[model samples]
Target: MAVEKLFESENFLIVNKPFDMYINSDDENEKNTVTYHVASPDSHLSSSLFPLHFVQRLDYATSGVLCIAKNKSSAARAGKLFEKRLTMKYYLAVVRGHVAFEVADIEFNVGVDPTTADSSHRMSALTTSEASERCLQSRHAHTRALRLETGYYDNRPVSVLLLKPVTGRRHQLRVHCSAVGHTILGDYTYSGTRDSMPHRMFLHATRLVLPLPEEPLDIQTAEPFFSDPKFSSKWRSDTAYYKYRNKEDFKGVCDILNKSYVIGVQYKMYKM
Candidate 1:
């Protein structure tokens, strides 16, 4: 499936990024550039001379709403919003098993460690140090997981969650989920699934709230929106995943998200 534009303007644009799609063109191979999809008139790729500057990043496995700053001024303003913690972003994730509830407010930083090439959200780090060229490299790190929603899987609840990042780091969600002992269903690197997620990994970046050009602006939000492929389901499952069928412990993951988001609402405005 090609990239889909949800909305665009002189100041901003929102694109529906597909699973397995790379967000940045600098790293995009000829086969999968976001610009190629937007540049061609065939798809939602727009024909603006102004470039699409990505404000935030999502892992290749994740999907859904991504904001782009159309002009340099908006890009600068939006960048500040993210840095100042004034932006509100939300994600919907499908995790393994059922959630036992009441574990939300899971806060921690995600920092890189030279000693360990790997990081897990398990909040389970036992630190180590490395000396490279007479320099010591170390970091204090921890992360948390909580149940957000328990949707009906034949009257049995399945864990669906809204993951909020306190300190964004590479593979934070996957690492965190893996740390919790309940890895995401389609995650192989984090979950230790021998062969996981035939299609793309099952994470989505559902919502983003952008502030207006006007100072102290009200929040503009995009919600429950998906610009999926035209023949989405026809895509075959390409990867095989290991199922850790732990249905008993997961329930009502959404409730946790709502509670946490409500608490954090007064913090900031996030827009591109």
Candidate 2:
């Protein structure tokens, strides 16, 4: 599978990463990865000009905008932006159940589940009391949810959520959404089963904003698979799936949040 380039510059490259592709692979023989395509001398990009480095990671099943730095200095700058919580990461997800809150901030502590014997370690959400008792090295995770649209598919209620994660913890969005009783559709790990889920996970990294040295880099990607008629047919005709068709709608969301942030700049700026 070819990686789609969304935007590129002297300092960095942004690509629309497809589902099931790794940002980087552990094995040199593994050729199906974003790094391989961008860094390979034989590939379309000039490998020497931009020694690509992944700036952010997405789950194997998740799809959306991924940033790659051209050099060590650019990578370090981007890392500092993320560390300072100045980077804005937006995700779109179709989840089960009608989400009650129009907007909410979910705060949960995450820790590795010791009982899982599989190589793919599963992270568990710890209750406040459990967090204190276990004394496990836990990280606080935060996810902001905005209800973009609502509809039903196959007689089951589902909603599309615009999620902004403040903390970059593993499976933070998945766990927080589930903690609020709305698990992302097709998330077998958190939602229990993928029996009725779509072929791909519903989560997509739709937009990313980073404060670069030159200017703020606002990169966006169209909904990878959700906008396709094949997926739309499953939803009701009057759902948000139809309303959120263009980039303008996404921009409107950002604008509204920006206006809100202006009032509480300190705390709201870092959140959605």
Tell me, by lDDT, which candidate is best: 2
Per-residue lDDT value at 197 in model 1: 34
lDDT of 2 by residue, 1-272 (tens): 88889988888889988877877765668787877876763232334454566778888888899988877888889999999999999888888888766666677786665555354446666655745443245687877777778888666888888888889988888877776788888788876665345776789999999977685799888866556666777777335523454687886775544333233222321121
- The global C-alpha lDDT for each of the candidates, from Candidate 1 onward, is 0.51, 0.74
Badly placed stretches (over 4 Å) of model 2 are 41-50, 117-120, 131-135, 194-196, 237-243, 257-272
Q: Which stretches of candidate 1 lie over 4 Å from their true place?
A: 27-29, 40-50, 113-148, 151-158, 193-198, 213-272
Per-residue lDDT for 89 in model 1? 58
What are the per-residue Cα lDDT tens digits for candidate 1 across 55-174? 778666677777777667887898888877666555656666665543444332334433344543222222223222221221333233444444433232346555666545566666
Model 2: per-residue Cα lDDT at residue 246: 69
Q: What would you estimate as the lDDT of candidate 1?
A: 0.51
